[model samples]
Target: MQRAWVIQFAGLAAILLLLAFALPRYAQMVPEKIADHVQHHLHEKGMTWAGVRPAPGHSRSVLLNGSAPDAEAQQAAVNDLRSLWYIQQVQDTTTPKIIEPYTLHIQWDGDKLALDGYVSSAEDKAEIAEQIRSEFGNNADLEKLQAGLGAPEYWETLIHTVLLKEIKPLPSASVRMVGHTINFAGKVATTQKAEALSKALRPIEEKDYHLAVNIIPLDIIEPYTLHIQWDGDKLALDGYVSNADTKAKLVEQIKSAFGDNAHLEKLQTGSGTPKHWETLISTVLLEAIKPLQSASVRMVDQTLSFAGKTDTTRQAKALEKALQPFAAKGYATSVNVIALDNAAVVCQREFNRLLTQETIVFSTGGAGIHQESNALLQELADAAIFCAGTTILISGHTDDVGNEEDNFKLSEQRAKAVKGWLFRQGGVPLERMKTSGKGASEPLADNDTEAGRAKNRRIEFVVEGI
Candidate 1:
C-alpha cells in the first residue's frame, strides 16, 4: 500500500508541473501574468524607480528613471530579456545610495529621442533633454520634432493648441489679462477684425472683456482733375473742376487779366448763368482761348470778334502760339479757323459756308485717355454740321481689358448710354442712331503687356452707317 501511494504522488506531481507551464500562457501572450512576473522579479532583486512620467505614445511604459545596478539583471528578474537583446545600449548608471553599491540607470534607448531623465550623468540634469541623434546622419527626419511629456496624445494636444495661441501672460501691444479677464485699449485699422476676435473668444463667458479700437479712412487725395477742354479754335473750362488747386492753377495760367476769377472756384458750384453777361463773357473768353482760330482778346463781352485781316500764314503762327499752353497741358484741338474769322457766326455756319462738313465727335474725359485722340474728338465735334434728317451714327467703344463677362456688359451698357444721350440728352431722334459692343476681342493693339493694355483700354467714336 505504501509503494502504490508513492507512485500516485509522483504522477500527481508531474501533472501539476505541466499545468503550471500551460496555464500561464494562452498562445504567446499572458500580459497580466507578465506584469506580475516583472513586478515581482524587480522587487525581489531590489530595483528602485525614481519617476514614472508621461511620454509620447498610447502606452505609458517608457521609464524616465530607474536606479537598478544592472539593467539586464533587473529585466531578467522581471522575466524580460528585452534589454539584453541589444547589448551595446544597456548603459549602466548608479548613484551612491545606502542599500545598493552602484544602481545603474539607463542613459539611452537606441537612437530614439531621450527625455530629460535619460541623460543621467552624476553631473547632468537639464530641464529639457539634449536630443541624442541617430547614426543615419543625412537622411534624418529633420522636420519630425519631439517634445516632452509621456503619451503622444498629451504632447500632440499641447503643441497644436499653442501654435498661434497667445500663451499665458499673452503678448500684445495693448492687451492685458488678469485671472480670466482681458482688457484691450488701442487703435485698430478696422472694428470688424476686433469684433471677430471677440466673438471667437466668447467661449470664456466668465471672463470680462474690454476693447477700444480706432478707425480712420484715407480717400480724398485725387491724383489730378480734368479742368480745361479745348478744340483748336474753341475752349471751355468744365464747371466741375472747382477744387482749390485747379482753380488756382487756371487763374495763374490766365495771368494779369484774369485776377480773382470767381468762376474758377465756382466751376462745379453751378451758380453762374450763361445769360449773365459776365458769365457769358468768361465762357466766350475761354472758348476764344483755343488756338485753331485766333481772335484778339479785348475784355469785351457783347461784340466778341475775330476782325484781324492779317494774312493766313501770320494768323496760323499766332494761333499755334496761343494754343501752346493748352497743348502742353494735354488739350489738343481742331477748332475751325473760319468760325473765328468774320466769315461765320457759329461752328455749323463755319462748316456750311466756309469749310466742308463732316460728322464729328468730342469727349472731355479723365487724364487716362490719349492726348492726340482727345484733341481730335473736340475738333471734330465743334466742326460737325447737322441737319434735320441727317443720320448721325455716334458709335462709341471702350478698352478691351476686363473680366470677359464684365467687359461685355460694360461695352453694351456704354453703347446704349451714348445712344440715349444722342437721342434723349442731345435731343436727336432715336431712329437716327444706334449702338454696338465689340469687347476686348477686337483690340487694335497687342494685349500682352501694360502699355498695350492701356492703349487697348480706350473710348472711341466712329460714324458707322452714315
Candidate 2:
C-alpha cells in the first residue's frame, strides 16, 4: 500500500512539470492566433483590416476597426469574427454616421425681404441676406431669423452665386425648404426676365438636388410714355418705348410720315409700353399732320395733346379730324394751330427732315443698295434739288461685329457709294454731298441681338445750312 501511494505522487509531479513548460508558450501564441484568424477572414471577404489588438492588461477584450467596399462584405467580416469561440465582445466604430437633412426659407413683402428657417449658422444667414441686398439695391429691407446648425460648407457659395448673379430682380419673392431641396416662388417684372432666371438655374438642377420654382410676371397697368417734337423740317423723338420691336415700329412710322424731308433725332428707351398707343401715332395723328413749322405732341395714359404752327387751315382741320377717333375712345387732345409760312427755311428744313427719315438700304457686307431702295433714293435726289444750296451729308454706320479698322473702311466705302449714287442718279452735284463713316459708333439701338444689329447697320443723311 505504501509503494502504490508513492507511484501516484510521482505521476502527479510529472503532469505538473509538463504544464509548467507549455502554459507560458500558449499564452504568448493566443493573441497572434486571434489576429491572424481575423485578418484572414476579412481578406477572404474583400475587407480592409486595420489591425486587431488585445486590450492592454486585459486577456479577453479586443477593439476592432476595419472597412469594406460594401455593406454585405462588412456584415460577412463581422459574422466571421463572432463565430470564433475565443472572442468575448466585439465593438465596431467603422460605420458611417447618418446625416439629417437641412433647409432654409425666405420671403419678400413690399420693399422688405425676410429670411427665416434653418441655416448652417448665423454667418450663413447674414451672407445670404447680403447677397440679396447687393442685387436688390439699398431700398430693399432684409430680415434674417434663422436657426444656426451644421450644413455642407459648399452650400454658401452655391446659393449666393445663384441668387445674386443668375436670378432676375423681383418685387416680391418667397423661398422654402422641402426635404433636401428648395422651392422659390416670385413675381418677376417681365416674361423675358423670368426666362432668364430659369436659364440661370439650370446648372443647379444637374447636381441631383430637387428644385421647385415658380415665377409670375407683375401686371403693370400704366405702360411707358412716348413724347415727340415735330418741327417743319426737324423731328425729335425722345422717351420710353415698350421694347426693341416697338422702337423699330415707331422709327418706321416716322420715316414713312415725313419721307426724307425732315430731320429725325430719335432717342427712346425700351421698356414695356401700353397696348395700342403706337398704333395711334402711326396710323392716325402723324399721317394726318400735313405741314408744320413747329409741333409738340405728348401721348400718355390714352391722352394726346399737340401744339404747333401749320401753314394752312386745311392742315389744322386734318389733324383735328384724325385725333377725333382717339377722343371717341376716351382720349383727350388739345390742338393749337398758327398761320401759314412757306419760306426758304421751310424748304431747307423739309430737305433736312428727308435726309433723317430715309435709310438707304444696302446689300449685306457690300456698298450696293437694295433694289427696294430706288424710290427712297429718288425722293432723296428730289430733296437735294429742292435745297440745292445746302450740303447733303451722307453718313454710314455698321454693327459691332467686326474689327474696328475693317468696319471703319467698310463704312467709308458705303458712304462714298451713296454719294456717288446721288450725284449720278439724282442730278445732285458732287460738291453738294459730303460722305463720312462712323464705324459702330453712335448706335441708335442695342447691338446685342440680330434685330438691333439690323437697325445699327444704316445710312444716315444730314443737311447743313438748312
Candidate 3:
C-alpha cells in the first residue's frame, strides 16, 4: 500500500515539473504573437510609421511607438491595434508631425505635371494623385508629397479646384499655396485666352483667398512683312506692327506726312520683328519716297525695297542719296526711279533732228562708247531731257557680219551702253529709258555695200507715251 502512494506522488511531481518548464515559454510566445498581429493590423490601417511591441509584464497589451502624421492618426492607430482579437490594450507613444508654413506646389511645364510639398493625410495625398493621373495620364510626378500636420483649412478642396479648373487647362502653368496665400501663373496662346483665365480666377480673389494671378499672353510672329503704298493722292499702310502703340504711332506719322489721306489695310499687331524695324519704315517713308509722284515700299524681315517716279533727274538723284544711309546700315535696298516731263511730242521731234544731224558711235565689237562720239551723245542727252516724262526707247542695229545671236546680244549691249552714258553724264534716270536690239533685221539701206551696212549699223531713238 505505501509503494502505490509513492508512485502516484512521483507522477504528480513529474506533471508539476512539466508545467513549470512550459509556462514561462508559452507566456513569452503569447506576447510575441499578440505583438505581431497588432503590428500587422496597424500597418494594414495605413499607420506604417507606428510601431507595436508587447508591454512589459502584460501579455495582452502592446505599446505603439514612432511618429504619426497627426494626433488623430495616432489615436486611430491605437484603436486599430486594440481591435485585434488577442490585443486587450494599446499604449500609444507617438508624436504628431508638425510642419510650419505648410506649402503645396504644382508645376505644369507644358508637358508634365508635378506635385510637391505636404498634405494632411494619406487619404488626401491619394485623392490628389488619382486626380492628377486621371487628367495628365502618365505625365505626372506625385512622389514628393508627404503626409503631415499644419495644412490650412479646406486645403484639399482648394488644391483640387486650382489643379483641375485653372492650372490643368493651361499649356504652361504653376500654382503655389502657402498658408492662406495662393499664387497662380500661366501662359496662353492669345490675349483673349489670358483675359478669359483672369476672369475665371476672379471668384477666388473675391472670396478673400489672398490670390495673385499672373497670366501672360504669347504674341509671336514669323516672317514679318510690312508694305506701304502711295498712289499720287493717298498713302496706305498694311501688314504687321508690333503692338497697339506702334500701330497708333505709325498711323499718326502717316497722317501727318500725307495730310490725312491715309488708309489702313488690315494692319495687325504681333511680336518678333527685326531690330530697328520702326525706324527703317519711318525713314523710308518720311525721307525716301515722300516727294515722289507714286511709290511702293516693301520690307520683308531685314530687307527694304522701293520703286517710284519723279518729275526731274534732280529728284531721282536726291532719292538715291536719301537711301544711302539705310544701305550703309546693312539693309538691302532696291531703288527704281523714273523722271517724266509733260513735253513728249516736242522731245520726239528734237531727237529725230539730232540723230539725223550726227551719229553716236561705240568701240568695234564692244559696248564701250567711243570718245569721239561724246559730242553727239551730249547733244542726244540734252534732247532727251525735254522728254523726261516719256519712255525713250533706244534701238541698236548691226550689219549681217556675225552670228545672228551674237549680233543680237551685241546690239542690246550697245543700247544699254547709251542708256548708261545718259544716266552718268547727262543726269537722266535709268528707269526713264528702255533698250532694244535689231540685228540686221531692220536695215536703213542694205548689207551689200559698206556705206549701206554702216547706215544699218546705226542707233535710233523713239519717244513713247506721247
The candidate that wins on lDDT is: 3
TM-score winner:
3
Give a tens-digit lDDT track for model 2, residues 1-466: 9999999999999999999999987886776677677766666655664446654444554556654333444455567677778777665644522224655566665466555545555466677667676765665444545533345555566567774454435777777754447677887777678777777776566655677889776643355556677656667766666567876777777777677664445556554455566677677767655465666677776667675655666776776676687777677776644334332354456545655676678877888888788888876775565444567788888999989888888898999988887888878899888999998987889999998987888777776653
Q: Per-residue lDDT of 1-466 in model 1, one digit per residue for the tens?
A: 9999999999999999998898655523443344344445445556544222222222213223355433443343333423423211222232322221111111121222212211122122221222223221232232323221122122222212321122212212233322223333332233344445455444334223232322111221122222343333333444333235545654665544433432343244221111232333334445345333333332121222232212244564565455444334333333334322322233334333321223222243222223344334434333332233334444334455557777665655555655554454355567755566666767767878876765554434443333
TM-score of each predicted structure versus truth:
0.25, 0.31, 0.45
Candidate 3, run of 10 with poorest lDDT: 337-346
Model 3 lDDT per residue over 101-120, tens place:
89988899878988788989
Q: What number of clashing residue pairs does each candidate have, in the order they appear?
A: 21, 11, 4
Q: Which stretches of candidate 3 lie over 4 Å from their true place?
A: 1-13, 43-50, 66-72, 84-86, 95-118, 121-236, 242-246, 258-263, 270-466
C-alpha lDDT of all candidate models, in order: 0.37, 0.66, 0.80
Off by over 4 Å in 1: 2-227, 230-236, 239-250, 254-262, 266-290, 293-466
